[model samples]
Target: MQDLELQAVESALTDLVDGERRWATTTLEQRRDLLTRMRELTGAHAQEWVDTAVQIKGLDPNSPLVGEEWMSGPYVMAASLGVLADTLDHLAKGRSPLADVKFHDVRDRVAVNVLPTSVYDELLLSGFSAEVWLRRGVSRAAAKAEAGLAQLDPSRTAGIGVVLGAGNIMSIAPLDVLYELIAHNRVVVLKLNPITDPLLPVFSKVLAPLIEVGAVRIVTGGAEVGGALVQHDLVNHVHMTGSARTHDAIVWGVGDEAVERKRAGDPKLTKPVTSELGGVSPTIVIPGRWSNADLKFQAQHVATQRLHNGGYNCVASQALIISSDWDQKDRFLAEVRNAIAAAPERAAYYPGSDDRVASALESYPNAERLGPGGGRLLVDDVRPDSAEPILSGEYFSPVYGVVEIPGTGASFTAAAARTANEVFAGTLGVNIIAAPASVKELGAAFDDLVEDLHYGTIAINAWTGVGYLTPTASWGAYPGHTIDDVQSGIGVVHNAWLMDGIERTVVRGPFRPAPRSVIRGELALSPKPPWFVNNKTAATTGKRLTEFAADPRASRLPGIFASALRG
Candidate 1:
């Protein structure tokens, strides 16, 4: 991998950037045309993308992750950059889909995503409930991104976007790339993390359409490469989904001179920076009464969120906040253990998941052990105040060590909320789990929790990671943030619409997840998940979802409708 010629790629990138700049500054129709071409290519080459994932990207042939990466990965990259929609039509309006289904028109007129909200809606929605997907345009958000760059502000500060790729997740790099290139209109130089470098060529393949058109470029190397990236004259905006230590090095550059610059409150230089840095996100349960099914369902939901992606995600709920007197915590914890035991041991992508787990167990010395497929740790009430730094340490293992919250001292919700506000590491997501009883009693508090958390996405019972899987949801740092104190990385990613006004988007799902799920991480033995309707039909269903998202009313609907029938 290291043998790849560097100079040739760099030269190619210079040419690519030139082309993108011309397109960005040019007319809207041209940009839209390029984006349309991107969409066509994505649909045309969908199978090739799946093939890349299977053979080159180390994906399981049957895992939902493959199909997801195909849609959100290469497909959404075009949706973000190739089709930049910075301007809005006057009196913007459009038809809306039923809300219960995951559907939204994020673009002007109508912009169906390669993977629309409907896939999730129909997949997750249950009962006879009807859904209406939102019909919103990108006018406000586009206006916001274009807001401060007026001619009057001569110093329109620009930052070179440094996307430090996640070694484990292929989608993170593309998401970072899009946010920098399209959402903020900044030039991006993406540094592939060492772990995932083997898959870089595969990404380049999926992105070939955009790359040929000069939308983005890729570079490969190690920490030295990353350091060089931050220091590059072209890079001003820095975003990474890695360890807190990595972030500290950037905040206060590493060596003596760097530390001096950081201490002085001004580095040798400064530009806008933002990130959803890694951290131990919290999943909370409000004390509540619930049916046995509800208790089991909510517990499994939280467990799967943490267990997803091998527990190396920025948004995984590292902390499980159970009400002091919830009585059901025992029943819930057991189910969580069962679910963790069910998830396959994913390759630890984060640099130090094992060490992080070791530290947790060292402090408590009583972490529970589970799992038939991989090494795992499960704990209960080890250290609510262990004098240990959960946020400071980096972990690369599948361990769910619990900390008990006294029911009387502070309600579980209050305690969990405090942790979220003050916890260390990155702020990506938080899942608040409560039975209907709790919601009914403290609905206002639930709303308050949503507003109070600094996370990028707040999911009630369902994991917010599901939101990232939904193209309709916007993924990135929370609103009202600047580079200096970016709770998460700057700007939004995976948002095809590029909503100009939204700082962070909150997506709420039902307490009990619907039967159709693509995640194969938790509560399952084989790659075959019970939620996929008929497991054999995953690929077909995936294709239909992609098609339906592209043009819901197109005559192609028959194929998608037929697939749904077959499923």
Candidate 2:
């Protein structure tokens, strides 16, 4: 992609900033109407958006697995836009969007229940729940102080911001734009990741209203375009969802010179920046006596977490922590391997997946290749202190490693959480799967487990992606990370509730997810969750799910179930 001329780039940014000034000053009523239009436009163009993504990614357009595109593409975008519009509508009526939200004190922090925004939300995403924990000393009155800030902030000035999008997830780029435009009230210029630029037209079309009003602009190019926009004077703030290497290159320079600059505490750009970079995420499995069926079910849960998006996700479970003392440990590992073997092999579609997988195999020759055509890797017997490839590496592929500590209950939980925080090199997301009995056994210590895990989002008996799908829950690395030791980069996004000073989000769900339930499962959640890369009806079912979410009706429920069953 050729970089646009400097003059043209500057002009576009100026136009966006001017439009953003108007956007920042809009009354709640006007802002609500604008977002309502955005939701409608996005829903209308949903199909084209998914289709383009499927085609560009070389997936079968007619296949149900195309649902991956729908969920990651139009579905997430439409869902997020709808949530933002609802927040604005509430604010226009002089009510806090989180007026009915529940909160409970946990030691020094307050955990705010941010899910189930409406009855429809609970009904649609059954059995799933989310809570956002505020940083210490942040009172209830100040919790959502910025929720009603459609008008200008007296302490802050309105200006244009730039978003450097991620190519792996279709929802990321547009969602980043939404965070800037709706939450922060900044006009935005979103530069598409060249790898996924084929969907640019679809994005432009869906965002036509915003484009016409000059509230947003869509740009296309590679590193040169990103550098120009990042260094431009008119851009007041910058947000990016990419790699830590990319973040360093953008903040410091590149090569040996950049390393020295970083060591000296000097950066190229002084403007404020926020980012969501990749990490080696972890999942902890508390030891407990379990029936074979329960073992089999949780194994599938762990497999789906790793194999989702071909393991391209930043939140994918890369490190699996278990207790060596558990009697069921061998059975669980066997079940995990069986599940991975039975699942269909997905193409290593991401740019570096093949090379990463190959490198991992060479480093750990004992690694077992699971699934058809060697599409998945399972490296077992990884000791807690071993310098294994999976321990320090972010494979970014359909690869997972298992580490066993010696203990049970609180001892195991503490060791696992500490290892996840200190050894993994990221505070992005972590998962904990424990039976109700096990949690009851630990009692108050369970709270300690939740508090000690230094991650932006934590999932209890669920995948971390569930937290990502919940809009009110903040999505980013944990706070207190610096540019010099930038693990998982920095900053938060997708916080539709307009909260500030967020520490982390915790989500809890049923450990067994009821039998034959639509939203829960041992083998799969519902009949077919599009996240399973092997789901044959993913495209159609995903499309149906998105439509139902966009405009929920009792009549649409049967069709969604039918489509899900077909896959």
Candidate 3:
């Protein structure tokens, strides 16, 4: 918005391009040092950042908002720093390398600088999922950068990189910027979403080094600012981690131009663009024989997926595609509604969430409202509804509705297969809550579901959001795309492993949980509940989770024992 800022951004891009030669030559050690400095600055200044996030956004430090603040708090901050360290350390020893991809004798990758902007204190109870992505992402970028340096195209002119950030999450912008720079070696000019612009001063403080290095800079404004940036002559590569609507507008270049472009096999602009647009994910509850414990654990798991982020995430379990005839289906739906109702009221992230919820009710007069306060949740008991039509609409509040349409003999399995084809939000994750018998009976069907589901990440008895948290999981829209058909996004993000993978990631966990439910106890937005397995004992559970994540298959017994013993 300022002339000086414009001048600085121009200068920054010029410097980055002028210094391209040194980019490949820049050692991983140097990059690591920059990341280290960023982590330290973020951790040290966590409180100020927290204060800024809270005050500027005027977000309540109660229930859901507090939990999100926790992501910015110490837990998230420390974890981000740790993962970053772990990633750098992985490269410090020269572990994995990927240099095969080349384009016109030019390397398109560079070391991405992950700026940790978490407020550690608030998130102490909750685990930081983004850390899982960032830590692994940095190392992957380093490896990519190493290979890119070898395939450098000295004559290739660098392109303008435009990044439009997400408003709900704190580190999304920084991480996206890091990816564009480190993953593709592109210089970046990031535009802050207006919703969180108040935190600019603090973010400016945290990202000073990126600005100082002339690799990244931030510009603040609204739609006009974004439109101008996208339209800028120097800008070439565009990236946004927000709404599908925005991506559509950007790809087609909003208005009459967009309409014209759609008519052809082209967009308003032909330039290469990438995005991490939201998804309307589904959680498939495969029916099978299970004890009460299995039902409880899986029900809670589904509830957590929808409840996280105040139920505003693109990947939130929008459609509970289940076998309507499964005997446990009604019970599962009941428990899920109860869990959602029991959940405390959350602050809606999207600006018009309240209106959206109200509109949804008005649109579907039959939708039943739940929770202590009716606004907390609304159960829209859906019956096919013209094959998953609710998914076409975006609901912001924690509404745990059921679509209990009939399934054939493999009621659950068959329903999952059917819904997988119909749901909106191309990016999705299938949550399978099943007993061992069910897994076996439906393993082949599950395999096909994995092959068939359009989701980006598939989780088992847990929220797909965990995939986003795991750091190693590749996050992106489903890959089969053409300009007009592009659903979720064009590329992937937070993939630390850098596996050129085609298979959808499946996160498998225990069927029935040990009493210590992380989400209910420590990770809850507020004080620990007495029944929360985590409330009575967090240390025991934390250690178990740590071990489980470190080594799952090999270390199953302890995990089982811990779960059985209630941690």
What TM-score would every model get versus the actual structure? 0.76, 0.93, 0.77
Give the least accurate 10-residue stretch of model 1, judged by summed lDDT.
90-99
Instruction: Please list all clashing residue pairs in model 2, or write none if there are none.
Output: 64-537, 64-538, 64-539, 67-538, 67-539
Local lDDT at 160 for model 2: 83
Model 1: per-residue Cα lDDT at residue 4: 53
lDDT of 1: 0.54
Summarize candidate 2's per-residue lDDT along 1-567 as a digit string, tens digits: 243446657778978867866665667777667777777777788888877777666765666557777787777777777777788777777777767778888789877887766766665555667899989998887775555453324124358889998988888988898888777777899988888889888888877778887889888777888899999988998999987888989999899879889878889878889999878888899888778777987888888788777788888898789888999999999999998787655567789888999998887788899888876889896766536668776788988899888888788888887888778867899999998778889998888999999999999988888788777888999999988878887788998877778899898766764454333333324443456555667777778877865665788877776765665
175-273: candidate 1 lDDT, tens digit per residue: 677556544656566778876766666667655645665656678877766666666565556777765556667766677866676567775436555
For each candidate in the order shown, give its overall lDDT on alpha carbons: 0.54, 0.79, 0.57
The backbone clash count of each candidate, in order, is 36, 5, 22
What's the lDDT for candidate 2?
Answer: 0.79
How big is the positional error of residue 187 in model 2, measured in Å on the Cα after superposition? 1.0
lDDT by residue (96-155, candidate 3, tens digit) is: 333322212102222221111223222322222222112222345444554322113322
Worst 10 residues of 3 by lDDT: 102-111
Q: Candidate 3, which segments miss by more than 4 Å at Cα?
A: 1-25, 56-65, 72-158, 376-379, 385-388, 408-411, 501-503, 515-567
Error of 1 at 182 (Å): 2.4
| Position 123, candidate 3: lDDT | 30
